[model samples]
Target: MASDTDFYSILGVSRDAGKDEIQRAYRKLAREYHPDVNKDPAAEERFKQISEAYDVLRDPKQRERYDAFGPDFRRVPPDMDPADYARARAGAERRTSSRGDPWGGGTGTWEEWPEGVRFSSGSAEGIDLDDLLGGIFGGRGRRGGPIPGSDQEVEIELSVEDAYHGGSRSLTVEGAGGTRTLNVKIPPGVVNGQRIRLGGQGAQGLGGGAAGDLYLIVRIADHPRYRLDGRDIHVDLPLAAWEGALGASVEITTPGGPATVKVPKGTSTGRQLRLRGRGLPNPKGRPGDLYADVKLMVPHRLTREEERLFEELAGTSKFDPRRRR
Candidate 1:
């Protein structure tokens, strides 16, 4: 029978929680009960229990079945055959003890006990100090040292334009052995701090295990004229004084290409112009919008003839800049 502790209750989250929510809850609890950090005797056991719960709940199909059938739904019936029970018990003991070789073959040496008695292979044998110490803590054997390899991490910075348009880039990474050029593909509309995983590109695994994965974290560079909010791209467009008053078609650069936008007459400095379907791409493969904020630019240095024309125009025109305020 399953224990009384509810998996959802232990994680302090609802059973219907999503994968991200469950992962967040598990991370919180793992950090709190981690054996290395907590230094309590029960912390390892609690962490193991939480890991088991996460393993089941993180999978969508498993979570669905578990939710529908309850915790004991997969348990073996009490009237099972003796051989089946023995096999189940052996499997459980193997997982719990970690005494024998992980592989099926038993070629590894085993500690010798008294002539008449024998415990598990890695268990305490006779009255040896090392065996006694191993049982007290986890049953960790002084096997061969870890395979010689080093893990590495790299961060790449991209402009908002690059993020909007997917492209290939070549980066040079310096490692312990030497520098290597890695050709990477930057996906369109990738957000800042997003990670791309490259399998088998990290440190080589020890004892023929699979290699770790390399994570590439994306960081968007700050733009002087543009700001990004979700899939929307915002830019401050500086316009000439006459352009705002007269209203003209102006060309602007977009991620797709240069396109001309129509400016309405009497446009204010804070007026916003939206270009539909010209922003970043969303997860559902749809494009967003681009917003342009108009700013009027007045000339500081005017020729003598231009100044005389402006003075004459100002006398005839009744324009007050602060009339609205």
Candidate 2:
């Protein structure tokens, strides 16, 4: 019931091929015969033929009309019955065979038509090969070409400590296609709003096109102690009043680990001590710095001995309280 030039036959799909199966077949053939990829002179024309077949078969409406009316479906009236059209075409073929016209002078089969009859829509009394070829190819210049897949972006949240140390993380993404889990690698010193590209992991392309890339935008989580500003980390360093008055080596917690910093003898509140390369680790550049902001704390209640010492110092010291510098 099918000919070599039939849309389904051209695309190498059966009459009952599903949409996915048809697409797969078309993609396979397109990759082999696409003009851009294939340099053979005959390949261009072959590609056009396959592209035309795919264009019509890919659409449900077009495919339905094509299945009902064959290659002349476009010329057949929408309201016309399939049986009536078949009867009319058979009568026309018989007339053409008797006249012995230039259209191969035989049965009006698809192969008997001109070598390249681009199917298009228009009014026609009967099957005119030249008219049909010119009408279809000239009307809408649509063809099946490889369309590059679209890039997809997703946001991933990471803790400050996780960001500090580069490691592998398991991420599950829920989308219209359902849920899929991926093992993502987190780079050290990745700042907020940074994007990590995963090649060939985006939306699938059509007509054997290249798959797009997937971008993972990093969002750093807020930490209780550490404040992130780019790669630099800021943390409040609480010290006793005595520690501020006299320099001492105090231990502090960093995203990396614990580190000891020396406080100056005249250290005051709001003073920051800089620690080089103690912040987040940089995978591809210089590491970040850490700032320890000093905050002096005084005991709400002190023992009698501590109060006496404080009073003695207040009485003996020449440093006037609240004196203008």
Candidate 3:
């Protein structure tokens, strides 16, 4: 019953959490609420629930099957009959004891049993013990059969530009056996550690089980021009001395494209310019804002004529950089 808890919710992790993330969350919670340390009335139940969730999620095969069929999978009807099932299981043990083939030996092998021991069906005339034994001793059928292949994990790195505008990328995954090329679609505004699931791309299932999924974890590379905070984008824009002294409209680059931003006249080095709806897109279809911090740049090496102009301007004006400080 404890295993019936939703694996994702029980682990306090998202459905797309990576293996290490899930393991870490489980370990943290397990340590905090372990029954041995917490003697509350409900401690044992909570601990069992946490352990159950980890048990299935921690195993690749079991997790794949659980993900494919959900929590009710264990209740699915088994393929074998009750009587035959018991006999077949017992035969497996006996065979193992005698060092014979435990899994019903290949197609047409006769099972050797003791002489004169007749297991009778209650009707009337005793049934041939050998026939009953043969039917029960049928080769050990596949146990648990083949399950859908385990899910695979791959990490992908993206540039900030790519993350701003949705794009497609080609990636190669190297596994124990070989490599596979996958074309992945990167959605706009995909943040670091977000995962994309590719269904039916995992290991091949045993028997008729469906294939597992392939998960791609996104990693966004740092950009020298901009810094990100949630959906907002921040950038420090350089302004000419005149532009900082007098208000001006300047062109700036944004993830969406280039835009003209109005800089208030007399704006200081730390003045902020805001462009709305230019940031990352939110889940509710709203976009974040872009913030520009204006920084003034002074030109070096003035010409003789420029020196005279500055001399006259300085005599007429009373501007000083250290006045505030």
Best by lDDT: 2
What value does the lDDT take at residue 270 in candidate 3?
Answer: 86
Error of 2 at 129 (Å): 24
Tell how far residue 194 is off in model 1, in angstroms.
1.7
Model 1 clash tally, residue pairs: 0
Would you estimate the TM-scores of all the predictions?
0.55, 0.56, 0.56
**Candidate 3 residues 1-325, lDDT tens each?**
4545688898999877888999999879876775445668886567667766786787886686667556733422234344444555565456445443333333323334322223332332333433443334232213334334556667798877887886899999876547888788888886544556787776555455566667786667779998776567888989987887788889998888998889987888887799998887665578778999888987788899988987898999987878885
lDDT of 1 by residue, 1-325 (tens): 1134677877778967888899999889877875545769887567656765775687776565556445532232223343443443444355435544333444333333222222344333423443332222222112322222333457788898888886998888776547878898888887554556666666654444344446676667778766776567888888988899999899998777887778998988999899988888866667778888899997899999989988998999998998995
Ranking by lDDT: 2, 3, 1
Clash counts per candidate, in order, are 0, 1, 4
By the TM-score metric, which is better: model 1 or model 2? 2
Question: What lDDT does model 2 reach?
Answer: 0.71
User: Candidate 3, TM-score vs. the true structure?
Assistant: 0.56
